[model samples]
Target: MNLGRYIRRTAAHQPDAEAVVCGPVRLTYAELDDLSNRLATALRGLGLIRGDRVATLAANRAELVVTEVALYKAGLARAPINARLGATEVAHMLRESDARVLLTDAAHLETARVAAPGTAVKTVLGYDGPSELGPGYAETLDGTAAEPVEVDCAPDDAAVLHFTSGSTGKLKAAVQTYGNRLALLRKSVMSADTRIGPGCRQILAGPVTHASGMPLMGIFFAGGCAIVLPRWDAEEFLATVERERATHAFVVPTMVNTVLALPSARDHDLSSLRQLVYGAAPMSPQRIREAWELFGPVLSQGYGCGETTSGVLFLSTEDHRRAIEGEDEELLLSCGRPLAEAEVRIVDDAGAPVADGEIGEIVVRGPDVVPGYHNEPDLTAETFRDGWFHTGDLARRRSDGYVFIVDRKKDMIISGGFNIYAVEVESVLHQHPDVFEAAVVGVPDERWGEAVKAVVVPRDGAALDEAGLIEFCAERLARMKKPRSVDLVTALPHNPNGKIDRRAIRERYWAGAERRVH
Candidate 1:
């Protein structure tokens, strides 16, 4: 069945049930279905057809969810722009995706107005107000019919232009087709022990436009409720989880760290949370263990990029318990085995599989994987080859089939001819009593060609220095793999995707150099 039909079926089953709750706004399944139908009719009135592109530049709000369902009903592709991006970057994405319509809230109407002219966007609708850009979002839907749309879309028809976080360079769009979305929904609902059915209530703590919204379709398909937070505040998050009895939540490592450090973190009654799915970057095992101690064994980890439609590998709660209770400490570092029907391989440059425990490029083939980039044919050819998508991440597969991501192929440190995975060094650094966060990078060096450097953020009021951290790493890692220089900072930089910005850290030490590496 099509994605639009999934929600329609849910609405028919439980028309009066709560479908979405974003702060003061609460929408029933019937109301959500009717509103989306009106918006779809309005979009069709604007001359948009089955294959048109519509972009939403908003945060985790009701309008964003409404727009998504509307896009599906209207048979239009969605290009969700990151709300954190600047106007120029936002404009670049709109132009790249060739979006025909731009939708923004009151706060972002100015940016949308400035960006709409530089692209093929012919209409700008404000979700909150009637700005100079166009008519109000509600006004646009007022005169439209609340009837079901009948547009037919093939399984392979484009559904979403999901843009990458772009920490390294320009952002690229992964063309997520209707079939890919269906695959994602299937895996989520069928994943054992998830309990994502009627009465399931998941919290949207991060921007729903990105990874936080990946599982939303499955939740809607299962007739569950989605509670959205306007912005992430640790205290508010904990309070919401307690007050709403949130059943599931999706977060990154950074968010978890912040929530764990809050003074009142333990005060909330979080017994309602059954699963806390964490990913978007490599989380230190030390932090994961701490989380398990305070939050019970509900923590699950997902590993996938924008190209793979959110998650292809899932580290289940059972795996986390094994790590906490078993003697195999190494299992804690794995991202977990591939999901059902998904295949992952660790291959060398020649595309040959590597031996167990040997690091190699990660390639995946699955129904959920995106077709290719939006408009870049050469890049698409290079990334998607031989029926598999070549993820630039380097990883190693354990004998038990669990995959341990070593590092991004570009982020690996080549120091004096020795290969150092930054994740490995950072993992050791996290074991330190005083170190709160650490990022390792390779900087320019005259004699050794490249030197291993570390930038760190220490715990509040903790006494830590460069020499002490270096000595601590030397005890845990190889001599050459230890950081040659360590700099204590208040906080490390983060990219738009909430991952540590290692490229930004390298730029400071490698300034004036012709290239990043020797």
Candidate 2:
């Protein structure tokens, strides 16, 4: 089966429909289908065989979407590098994936040039224009003859080399297969909260090469328009939704915090928002309430990782209304029940199912779960055991089947003899009206072996001190869970996915310490 056939069918159905929009560039269904086919033909002409890898290192743009569809048509594995990565990380990916071709823009042409010297990258295609490193993107596609190119691929054929590094900072690629990707497309539309069809405009506001790109295939297959943000600015996001009449959006919690902080947030006409989904990190109950008020009953949440392909759990708009306007107040903390075709269970270390209200790891079994990592067999064996992919996340299932993520197994803070989840502490920190952002980490303590440290960023013009913030959390959380000390800073670092960089903040405190909790 060819994944690109879905796009071909959609194009045949609505040739003149808008498929993608970014900045000043807009491509109709005919244009997108034709360009991707031509680009696939061009890559094949360049001698890239099926299962060969093609890497792209660029920010959100119209060409990235084209490249994704092109790779699907060519039956080539996609290795998408985050644009925010430095030259060293980019070079590491080039070496690890051994990608034959690299696609980039003028902004990253120099970095690509610097990193492609001894790697397998034989050519680089520039999106903006021809550079010293490679030829122009538009000219290359224009030169190739547009044909209906679709390579038949097996179910287990590798489709995407999804690279991610959590707190450990070691990059690992999850080999997502063709069947897995098809499962992702199926699940995207099966859930009522994630469904998008014709006349549905979905805003992709983050880097499209990773988490933000998960919804693209479904949007294309369903004949929906994708409005890609050139860059992330809260005001620009609001304006784009109003201007494009966008009906759906998927954002990280950090992005939502920035939108809530905007003084004119309520003034914007966000009436077109049919579904506003947030994930990557848990949002505070207070922030959920604020977002519901701002976005007008469109807020929802999704929970998943690359290993699971995309989301396996979804908190729908009805769930949000039930929590915010109804009696299920604690439902605000749940990431929600299992989504479309996924089997989710909380299992102990021995892989035994845990009873309700018991904390354990979230193990998922589904067609969307990848087989294993590309080159790390040992790590793969450790993460994917038997038939279930271990999420390494600590969560508890309520009697009603709702799941609340306690924290990542690695992010749990061991203070004295107590197990304190950083997310639990951070949730209370977010309740303070003066706090804009907060990160909780465990630091070396001479007395307790390790102590909890809170790093907070106050809202604009809010005079919040460390004592006030610590006291606020103390009132809401357990005495042992309360931060031992608080640091009021201007901002907290974030990873490429818009999640708080607790690893970065914690590293500073444990840089040269003799004992470390993480």
Off by over 4 Å in 1: none
TM-score, structure 2 vs. true: 0.99
Q: What's the lDDT of the predicted structure labeled candidate 1? A: 0.88
- The C-alpha lDDT values of all candidates are 0.88, 0.91
On a 0 to 100 scale, what is the lDDT of residue 150 in model 2?
93
Model 1 clashing residue pairs (backbone): none
lDDT of 2 by residue, 1-518 (tens): 78998899999999999999999999999999999999999999999989999999998999999999999999999999988888888999999898999999888988997899889999898898888888888999889999999999999999999999544688889999999999999998886778899989999999989888999999998999999999899999999999999999989999999999999887778999999989888999999998998899898899998999999988888988999987798899999999999999999999999999999999999999999998899999999999999998999999878999999999998877889999999999889988899999999998888899999999999998877777787888878899989998998999877888888999999999976767
- Backbone clash count, each prediction separately: 0, 0
Write one digit per residue (lDDT tens) for candidate 1, span 206-250.
Answer: 888888888888899999999888888989989999998999998
Score every model by TM-score: 0.98, 0.99
Provide C-alpha RMSD values for all models, in order: 1.2, 1.0
TM-score of decoy 1 = 0.98
